[model samples]
Target: MPPARSDDDTDGTRAALGTAPIEPPVAAWPAVGTPADGLTEETGQAKKPRTAAFGFIFVTVALDMLSVGVFVPVLPRLVAEFMGGDAVASAAMYGLFGTAFALMQFFFSPLQGALSDRFGRRPVILVSNVGVGLDYVLMALAPNLWWLFVGRVISGVASATAATAFAYIADVTEPDQRAARFGMLGAGFGIGFVLGPALGGIAGGIDPRLPFWIAAGLSLLNALYGYFVLPESLSREKRAPFSLKRANPLGALVLLRSQPQLMSFAVVQFLSQLAHLVLPTVGVLYLTFRYGWDTTTIGFTMAAFGCAAVIVQGGLIGPGVKKFGERAAVLGGFACGIVGLSMQAAAFQGWMFWLAIPATSLWGFANAANNSLMSRRLGPSEQGRLQGANACLQGIAGLIGPLLFSQVYALALAAPGTFPGPGAPFLVAASLLVAALVLSVRATRRPG
Candidate 1:
């Protein structure tokens, strides 16, 4: 871990990490610089989407996350029910489900991004929507825990299209506008946050499977909407041949190595992604065990968190970035995460937890800022690949995060009293963010 850099660059090598002004990558990949090397996929390409069409990407990611959010509060409970309400067994099984899901995403993410690069983003996105919709159907109908587990695997494969969606954003946006646009895209996640959990909690209260049905309808309907509204973001000439070498999980990591500057960012991002998984994997369970909250309470609390995210990402991100710059924003986000998660970890009363939501909500500014910065360093032809590489990191985090946090939580529960309590998972997450904060400082430092 030499501070992430291509220090060999003349002067611009220092630009990407500097605070005053950031320059483009001096050594952007030239091997695929032009669209010349491979046979392009035969899929018919539509023209680049209109500016208004940008809304489609936002909506697409929203619907995708919304479907995910709908089950967050209840999925663990459903597993618990199948296990005779044994919390420990359910936690272990849920971690396995998460790990299995991440395995699929790890394998498929680069493929999804590469496929979008070849065939175009529109079809790749639409197909993912359909796949997700159908997977929800499977989950809704699952008679047993393993059946639901299988559904999660499918969802991971489908959800890997998030890389493509980000690629779509890169395609349509200017370099300067990317950070703001990325923030707007995060607002989509916020929308899901606000609605999905609340809806799932209410619906899940009636029947744990009900939220999946609702999620299925939403995904299908979104697919239909996209079929009519979403056009291709990548033009035919801009398309690259589908390279299996860059499409698999291992190959995707090679893509990260291919760019020396991205290594540090990718590493920091992996830690951030690992920290993020705690909420989904153990947040609900932690709430249930620690605070005695029911399904509805968990959902509403999540909704509140979502609302804060919307305000920060949707409303404040652009102005914040403009005033503070991406590096500053990134630093601020990590600081917020450390404080917020620590606050959540220390909160003994349920009401104190509410104050932590906004701080954590603001943590997304770091991701949006980091993405904008990374996307600027690559060419259009490689945006998908870069995001694929990043998603591969996320897949790895997804693989590790769930098991680590869930097991920590379960172990804490088994403890007699004092150390590693129910708050243990957040404390661990906060620690990961602290590591990220340090790594990011090194990554963002100007080259010597």
Candidate 2:
């Protein structure tokens, strides 16, 4: 016979689960153990662990930025090389590249996020990384603009890795520790942003395609690393039922309406992305036209911005969230965005351009904090859905921001002798950020 239970033991078991014996909850991603199967209690075989899985996700993101930056320095020059130094055609082609990437991301991010939820995060990540590597190889091989568009489409699919990565982090981490992990990813982004462009600048000195080759190599390395080491975070039992319609970005809109807090985050996302909208496209062109910066100079200036951002978001931002609270961090980030844009508009000399460096760094710090706080508001069950929604909001902002900024950039270029030089669009970006600051301040009053 089985051992007899004492009366007290029976009562304790009853109390634990209303008349059933209860098992202790398992700790997730502990320092020593492999994650067990979704429905099984047994722990899996031990494997070598590296936090670089998280860093790999960020590297993918940073390389995407690098690919953009690499092309950026040589874009005008490359068009010239091919089209007999046609400044207008170069500008148009450059803008088209930006438009293609943003447009494809807008359409694909939610789809990838949903697919990861239904299938598993690891597979999605592997596929996306491979896509990005291929995108770079294509860019390197492309003889003309049409191939560049193909490369953008391929890269955009992989760019969704970032959203899936955040979902993967959510899957593995405890609620309290998530903000710090998210900050680590942000920091990785900052590091990549710093290194990729600097490398691109160096490659640009040799050949425009060199940066693409380097990005491809880095991406290939990431894909190989993930295949061997990165474990699946999403469990088969916990995954939501997959639907093609859910994969459609329109589902994110429905999610926005269902969750009030998510709606608020969507607003914050739109504002933050809008603030960044000017930087990648118009910002680079503005600096180049206004200061007569060469590719290396522009690359270094961008790298400085990335370096400062990495420091603040990686080190300071996480602690700020824990100390002052997410609301404060969000408000602070918006405020910094306003300051950064204003400084960019007001700066005259080439060196004065550095003023926007700290401004953008502060922006990065604050935005990181805000994203962490937003992620905290959702339950584990909804992590991928919520992150996918967030990405959709960012995608919308990216799509619209470029269109708006490109128009302003064209206007400034058209009438350079008149208007406020190239600084007019930046001033507009500042004004928009100021409005966003007020909105973020108002959001702090809601319940966490």
Model 2 Cα lDDT, one tens digit per residue, 295-403? 7787678768777877887788766655555566666777777887877877888877796778667776556655665665554545677678778887888878877
Q: Model 1, residue 340: displacement in angstroms?
A: 1.4
Task: State the displacement of the C-alpha of residue 130, model 2, in Å, after optimal TM-score superposition.
Answer: 1.7
Give the CA lDDT, 0 to 100, for residue 37 in model 2. Answer: 18
Instruction: List, residue by residue over 186-279, the lDDT tens digit for candidate 1.
Output: 8998898778777887899999889999888988888888888887767788888888997887887877775555777787788888999888
Q: What is the lDDT of candidate 1?
A: 0.80
C-alpha lDDT of candidate 2 relative to the true structure: 0.69
Give per-candidate clash totals: 0, 0
At residue 134, what lDDT does model 1 achieve?
A: 94
Name the TM-score of candidate 1. 0.82
Q: What are the Cα lDDT values of the candidates?
A: 0.80, 0.69
Model 2 — TM-score against the truth?
A: 0.79
